[model samples]
Target: MTSTDTATREETPSAHVGPRFRPDIEGMRAIAIGLVVVYHAGVSRLPGGFVGVDVFFVISGFLITGLLVREVTTTGRVSLARFYARRAKRLLPATGLVLIVTVLLTWLTVSAVRWREFGVDVVSAATYVVNWRLAARSVDYLAEDVGASPVQHFWSLAVEEQFYIVWPLLLVAIAWLLRRRPGLRPRRVMAVGIAAVIVPSFAYSVYLTSANPATAFFVTPTRLWELGIGAFVAIGATLWTRVPRVAAIVLGWAGFVAVVGSGFLLTTEVAWPGYAALVPTLGTAAMIVAGYTSGRAGVAGLLSWRPAVWVGGISYSLYLWHWPLIVAATAYWGELSGWWGLVVMAVAVVPSWLSLKLIENPIRFAPALSRSNRLALSVGGNFTAVGVVAGLVLVLLVPSTSAPAVTGGASGSGVSGAGALSGTSAPAGTVDSLAEVEGYVPSVVDAEDDVPPYPEECQVDQVSPDPVVCEWGDTEGDLTVALVGDSKAMQYYSPLDAIAKDEGWRIVSMTKSACGFHDGMQVASGEPYTSCAEWNDAVVENLLDLSPDVLVTSERINDALTDPTDVTTRSVDAMVEAMTRQWTTVTEAGIPMVVIADNPSPGDVSPVYECIADNDGDLAACTFDRERGTADSGAAAQLPAARAVEGVRVVDVRDAICPRSRCVPVIGGVLVYRQTSHITDTYARSMQATLAAALVPQVEAATEDAEGS
Candidate 1:
């Protein structure tokens, strides 16, 4: 749009032409992949290394749309089969090879607990739908904390493939519908369609980002605008008089700076692929546009240099190789920093180059495999192979069925019976044995505590305004114990269920995924989680009416009352203020509620399951520092609020969770954390005795107070 005057094109017949292979674009690929690899390896100073994916998005939009536009201009038709064949040839060979190898290596090196989800990741990546699957997983608070899958990088590829599938069909539809209209040329029709999508997609991206940032990051529509910008550049290409050489040089250099420097300047903490993404997308588009001006003064010379072009040529393979290697490196070595990160990155090149030569080039350019049908068959074969590998990994990589029960048994953790330690009383908790997580069971990582059997009848999802009514505990028990809050509260279910049956208490759990019970904090991306507020309102009404014998509630406190404005991060005052109102309803009604302190975080960046697997069951190496481990826990902040109310009791398990200098991965012969911060249901169940010891007395006192009232 900036290149030429629209009036000059009124009389000239457009010369339809195929795009020449631009080395500069290859250079751009090098830059994009370089940023991505370095950032992911944790070797770069750039916090925004992820912006490289945005550059790739723009480049893909430009290249793919250029091909389609050229085809339509010359032949007035686009072949979906041929386009897909090319994509399959260009992408699938190396992708499938890497996926198969990654699966094998992950099985050998990573934990068994990750195998099941990684198995699904294999399928999702093979089918190029991993982005959507990841999007669903992102919003799930339970699944949200697991380790990054080796193929998680495939999400960008999945987005591009999804674009490829839809863009051509949309262009073809526009062409067919406008066949007789000379005013609506194929390029113009395509432009109109793309414009139609870009405006709403960008708007939705901003809105959804503010509402659900995690889902927005992976969803296609949110990323559509960045790609659409590239498409616009391709279809709207205009010839123009060159700008002053100095101006072009400055412009190109500036654009390059924006693209590369963004990584150093930006942090992942900010909401992304939103407006912030414009920095790299525009930078990429500007670089491409400036390259066309025919000058050595611009970035053209640097981008087209031999090393840049070569790296760009193998960038796809490198991208596939780098992430898995980094994941493995970090898992094995525990935080690959300084020279170690670079060494890990360098090792990936050998496999990347091999894939390029042995797997990628041979199949991609082979004369026999060039045909669309042959390529289609190859895609099918590769997909089938991947599926088989996934199945085998799931079957063979699982934990031993004969593994000893977690409780009162000795296992790999080396401590006998229930206690990893002999001096402490029953070693402070229960776990069947440390073998549950110590075995690195695939099901443990894959199946979140939020799943069935415990209770889901009254569970509310993130967006569900209405709560489902589910009942648990002894149906006719004399006393009622109502559990409430987010999935963090639901983590207590197994233990509470056990206690309920044993103590003859009726248990009713009112829970929501990711929603907190803090009245002051409206849960949403940046806006109010209207559903959570409504559900809280409804729960308050229910509590007013039912007023169970005892109310036990907990939330992802950090999510609940975390005021971004508070520099201290511990917003006890705000939490106390917000929670006081919610507690008031129960307090005024003379019902006693217990605010069970949230558990210590198991370190999201370094899950013990992965670390233990990587280090050959070295439990001490998997432990997280006590101070750093529980820093984000909302438990401390929630205390004042719980204490502020009448008829409210507090129960903190911090000592139980992080009893030593560091929070051990395996405690009392049981896995302490299932994923990141949530306690394993087994671990929670095992803590029943300790929980009963700490909780039963207070709960009994509360029940007596309630009965007296």
Candidate 2:
């Protein structure tokens, strides 16, 4: 969320006029950017350093609104073009510079597999729509595990840009309307307008944050209230008379405590930009108000120190340069922690100082650009030209992204542990074939063509209360397998479809995005996923009405780990309990249930595909410790759950994945997983023979046992 205002205060009309140099406010900018950069760099002491962005939002709102109010008061009419032109001059140059540099660096250094995605992020960053895009991406279940992109920081800039898009026009409308009413001063009318916006936007923010915090954090609507609060302060500041020194000092110290203390007090686990935002939002507003008093007093005095002011001078460029350095450093070390993080921040100073002295100041305050709106228009045009050129360069640069790493070794022959079961548990022989000829980005492929997913109506999201069953794989066949649960449950489609087609069976897909087959609530962003529980009951009813020959269920284990308490214990117990209850319904109805074990997720954060890409053609370099890599096969968590259900049988496929002592990155020359956890369609097709061998018998036995009873 880097902003144009981070280092300079040219946007504020108040700053340009009376009391021009507010060292206190500039120092505040230093504090905000410091928190944001440290938090992003993985400072263990400051988990809540992200609150710095909230502080930025408030400052922006205060400053920008101050400018707008001044324009309305002085001009008696607002020129939208001139206002936007000034904005373009102030914001576009540095932003465009960063985007170009970041894109160039990403293309050169990032894994080829991620270039296509990161390039797209560059486009979004260039246009200032990255925040909304990020918000949408956050809710996408498949995109959940992907690593952070370099331009992820642009989302904050996008939010502020979007705010400016409508705000000036809105103020113009308010000013025009107030002119018709002779008694209303511009300040009074603006305050009324600010209050009106704050009330509903704040309520909506609170509601959205509670309902969808992940999206809420990136969306403009949720953060608008914070900006509105700042605007309120700006308008009130115009009307506020001077206060006593003692009281003002007390307020300043209080603001400092609130702003700095929040870093230690808050955690990201809480739903943000909601009421949790008040601590930082109000504190920043207080700090700004305190700065208005004459002389160095309280927090203002502390902020006025030379070291803080120097950093504050370079704050914008520092914010710009720090993130990409951290990203590059992280990619080099394979991780960033402790001293490494501080090292990255220290190294970023070179670029930050260079950018400040070179790019930002030169263009931002150029004399030629100072006269007419020519500079503003030219900056806008120049940005378009450079942005277009950069986009084209990126496209040409990554012509052939390395395909998802599909290795060609034949299946491994065995597991080595003493207690490791032989025969059934042993790895298949010699994984020697490549399922895919080249490594492609699996997330993109999986999103589009991973498997034949049921339509949106059938593959439900959180909002769908009604379940729609879609059939494939010999839909006319007499034997019906009703596959149900969350996306993890949906992931089996590739193998199951192949199996059903070969065996003359109907495969009915009844799945939701994150809702597992269990009645227990699924958690996301630390909140009980809404609509999932209701959808569950509705799905179970739909399943009963269909009464297929075999009931199939699977769930991504991690999605159900929403509990903040002993997560492993709670998740396992919940899965077991939910499976018992749901399966009881099917078994009582004379239908047999078959549970497919969840696959092992490859890396802790980065997928094996990314690691393989990062490490060059050496796939072995990406091989993880079977203990850590395949650590929690939702399959393991699901073992007792599958066993406790009457008339339910479990089919194991872990042997197919982790055939050796460790979970190999590639099996039979094919990439075992196209996604972080889910197997690729091509790989899943290769495993069709194995899945059929394991699945068919248990399904038949369950059917036979039901009939015999």
Candidate 3:
């Protein structure tokens, strides 16, 4: 076969040094990239298309292992310098260019609020360590509502790069240790080493995916076994010669089905790269083995089609360019529709083709760099430097809009937040027009951090079923007041804290992010939130046992729920029923309740604080329609549920939050919403007097009834 054919046969970072170029492998690359592209583009049909990255991992392992094995058998030693140099030349040019482009695009198009975090992500991506960064952020409760980073897809690339860095050294060590043996071949020893890796890694993947899927999805250890599966196939290539043609043909087709069908059958709801990942990785192994053993009789005839090969030729560049383009487009024009996502994919191809033609190929195949490992490594370093420098520049460019600390809850600076609306108090700086966001208590840049300060470990996170009960204000008091529900209820704690201290009531808090306090199954990340259900049961049991004087609850029940009968739907009827049942149980136990109606959301407006910053503090531009915000809030269910339970009163400060049919971003001098749905600590604290005026009388009435009973 010609050199061109050979190169095409062993595409990707580590090319195969095997006997012949396998066109089927290149075609597989096309299939893999296509699945990933469609999935990222929001094509609803292929929810599990993310399995494409696992397939690429298998392919990389097979090719890289084969290359290392060949070098070892011929020269008696593996060269780490040459192997890594080849990887750098094959991958870095396009990656660096894309990183730089993403940085500039984000700064120009996305909000300044995202710039600092995006810059950190870009730097991590440039260094091929972004997966760890993403894993950390994935489990961070504060970052739960953060938008997708433009370079977030780099996590997979990071995993593959990490594998490439370590695999050769491991093989070299195994080969040396087995060198002193007489009968043992290095291949056999390598096979043992590969198994050692695959078993523990797969076990850990299963464990972590179950216990903490968010972190599990991005970490390196959980994915190492996928690459090892490919390595196993490469090491055992000789055994495939004995396989019968009929069996090989059957396996080939089955393997193809497993890979393609996984994209359709699985979804984002499934815990990934755990046992579920076996379908695609093993299927890839089967295809590679079938190609070697059965040749033309295998699935190669279909996979080796011209279009497939052409697409495969540019898959790497295509993968690098597609995601950032999608993010940038989304930032420029709101969330992309299915058609717009497809359009963005098409637009991405222009840059993908240009980078492949002008940069990726020419540098990868250049005579000087190809001949000298030192020169190739140097060029790679320069490219990486470009990406890192660009990232730092973006970080430095983050606007210095930090505001001085403002006194919260009955603002000492005369900035009475909700007091202005309730006619209780008005800020000296309060604008009569309320047209702009200037003089806001928390500057737009600091708005995200303007959340209530709970004691450490006071609130449970999304994954755990464990309940945390924290007490603030008058631990030794005559009356017990409990705050219960999701983060929405947690946001109201500042105002309650001030009231509890003033009234000499003990305040108890039990809250979890993304979890409602009702006994219904909620959905998180498109899957049944079993932990949420468990937490609800556990917390309710504790509350019933404690029999607090009054239970104050609120939640953003906008998420869908799985009914008791196991049908998941977005209908609020299920939530209303669930809330009524739970509230009845608590009220029957002599714990009267106050339901704080959920506040208006910054619905569909991504990065709400950023929008305020971008508009030069024009709060009017950031105002959402009151009808839309209120309809989407949990008040739809909260109001009805409160009526169904005796002694359960609802405290609605909606008028203070959204005056005159308009939900404003700032009230009085305080910025209101901290995230998409939850109000800021400053805003909640500002609304203290209003909440107390509405809440205390109801609590006293409930207390009197409980005492009489």
Best model number under lDDT: 3
Descending-lDDT candidate ranking: 3, 2, 1
> Please, what is the TM-score per model?
0.80, 0.87, 0.89
Q: How accurate is candidate 2 locally (lDDT)?
A: 0.71
Note the residue pairs that clash in candidate 3: none
Segments in model 3 whose C-alpha atoms lie over 4 Å from true places? 1-19, 44-47, 136-144, 207-214, 264-271, 335-340, 365-378, 402-410, 422-432, 436-438, 476-478, 558-562, 565-567, 605-607, 613-617, 696-701
Residue by residue across 178-292, what tens digits does model 2's lDDT show?
A: 7777577888888888887788878988998777778888998888778888888877775433756677778878888998999778888777889889998899888888776
Worst 10 residues of 1 by lDDT: 1-10
Query: Quick one: how many clashes does candidate 3 have?
Result: 0
Worst 10 residues of 2 by lDDT: 413-422
lDDT of 1 by residue, 70-133 (tens): 7777777788877777666667767777778878777766767677778888878877788998
lDDT of 3 by residue, 1-709 (tens): 0001113433422223346667788888888989999998899999989999988888878877888877777677888888878888888888899999999899888888778888989999999898999998886667866689998999988988887767888988876776666467877888998999899999999999988898898998999999899888878877776778888888888999999999999988788878999999999899988876666767977788889878777888888899999999998897898788989998888898999899988998899997999999999898998889988999999866643345544476767777667544433223334653346667766667888888748778888898999999788878998988888887877888878888888988899887776877777766677888899999999998888998988888754464543445657877888888888988888888999888777686535677777786666677777788877888878888899988888888877677666677777778777777777788788778888888888888878888998
Better of 2 and 3 by lDDT: 3
TM-score of 3: 0.89
Evaluated against the true structure, the overall lDDT of model 3 is 0.80
lDDT of candidate 1 at residue 49, scale 0 to 100 = 84
Clashes of each: 13, 19, 0
